[model samples]
Target: MSEMVIETSNLTRRYGKKISVNNLNLHVPKGSIFGFLGPNGAGKTTTIRMLLGLIRPTSGQIRIFNQTLPKHRMQILRRTGSLVESPSYYGHLSGYENLDVIARLLKVPSKRIDEVLGIVRLTSAAKQSVKGYSLGMKQRLGIAAALLGNPDLLILDEPTNGLDPAGIHEIRALIKELPAQYGITVVVSSHLLGEIDQMATHVGIIERGHLLFQDAIEKLREQNSPKLLLQVDKPLEAKRLLQRAGLQVSMDGDILQMPNQGLAATEDVNRRLIQAGISVYRITEQSRSLEDIFLDFVDKEGSL
Candidate 1:
């Protein structure tokens, strides 16, 4: 089993009467891409700030790489790299020069610049002026700067914020490759479920200053109760047949729906419907997407 790289116990942060983060207990496994998912104003940035010790938590604890925060801040930070929100770059300077300045500040070897540039696929545009780079290039450059520290853990807050579809795809691909290629544990935050669905190994969902869910991506999928939809000529009769077979069923227009019990159950439903003299036109199992699950969680929370 992998070690816990990030763990928070009742991590809370409040601003006067407004609570930004409410007892968020997050667990991130080592060598995994942990996607911090939430809607806007969900306190993702606030939690990240606390993790970096930029702001003190109201009351709670944070452990990174098995080291407690604030107390061992410098020791923890030395092994972590982060790119928060918009990246800062000297537009007047070339990409290479900008990285050179950062390297000098960190006192890292100058030769490491080229390696990072290649890692972010910015080596070809190393000499290009930052002012002329595209938004995607700038974001990649920000990631490159983060990599300059050669840290074991990388924290990125909305790394693909304002980019076209193609640009988002590029950044996602790069983030997915980091853990495998460099052995870095990544903690990336994003508001879009679809964005993280493609690359994240584990996901933590926060809403209204509260963490609604946290687990492996596959485990979340298992939590989704698959439903089978049946379109039949006799909806009422089909529903009756399914219910009589000890299956809970519902209906929507001409469609008969029931809990998906797997392939055998689905086949049994079809056969049973036919045996009852009901004509089954279509039997489709609808699986919930991550977006669907996210919205449901948020909506449910809002109601409570």
Candidate 2:
């Protein structure tokens, strides 16, 4: 079995009367880019801090690399690197100088600074003062610092928060390479579902402090059953026809959606629609987006 890099059991956190994070469970597999997803104030940052032993949880347990946090903090931290929210940098110092300081703090060799600078594509700007660096450059520098220790696990919270399109793509490509090239397990938090959907091998969705789902990206896609959209001139009659054919139909504006259980079911519905004289403007299969899936789950649970 693959080793679990990060696991939490019934994890909960509260701020006085407000329960910031309710009973939550998560399992992040080793050597995978695990995407942590949630809207604003969904406790993503808090949960991350707990895993890093930066803050104590209100209840439940957390284990990283099979060892409990806070208790085995020193050991776990030695093998982990993180940049939460925003990474701080000294404006006057060169990129290399900043990493050099961190290397000294980690007791890493001075030569390691050059190596990290190269990894983040900051070698060219190594001698340039950070004061004139662009937002993307600064972000890259932070990433370089995170890699200074060559940690086994890398946790980045909103790593692409302020980048433009090209910068975002650059950072994304770098993140995708971390697990494959360095054999490092990565946990990334993002509100951009589309981006997460593209990069993550595994995912965890949280809403209103509760964990809605956790599974492999492929498994999640498998579970999102395709539905058929019937765009017709007469939606009401079309819906009735589909229902009469033993197909469950949902009314959305001028569209009648029915679950596509199989090819036979779809063919049966099409035949029925034709027989009913329901002019089908369009009949298209619909795959729900991650945002759509998340909202449905949260609203169903009354947690939205």
TM-score (all chains, Cα) for each model: 0.97, 0.89
lDDT of 1 at 235: 95
Give the per-residue lDDT of model 1 (tens digit) for 158-182: 9999999988998999999999999
> Which residue runs does candidate 1 get wrong by more than 4 Å?
none
Model 2, 1-304: lDDT tens digits are: 7689999999999999999889889999999999998887888999998888888999999999899978899999999999998779989999988888889899999898988887888889999999999888888899889999999999999888979987788788888999999899999998888778878999998877888888898877777788888888788888877677676889978778778778887778877878888777788898887678767766765743
> Model 2, stretches more than 4 Å misplaced?
231-244, 250-254, 261-265, 275-279, 301-304
Report residue 145 deviation for candidate 1 (angstroms): 0.6
Worst 10 residues of 2 by lDDT: 295-304
Which pairs clash in model 1? none
The C-alpha local distance difference test score for the whole of candidate 2 amounts to 0.87
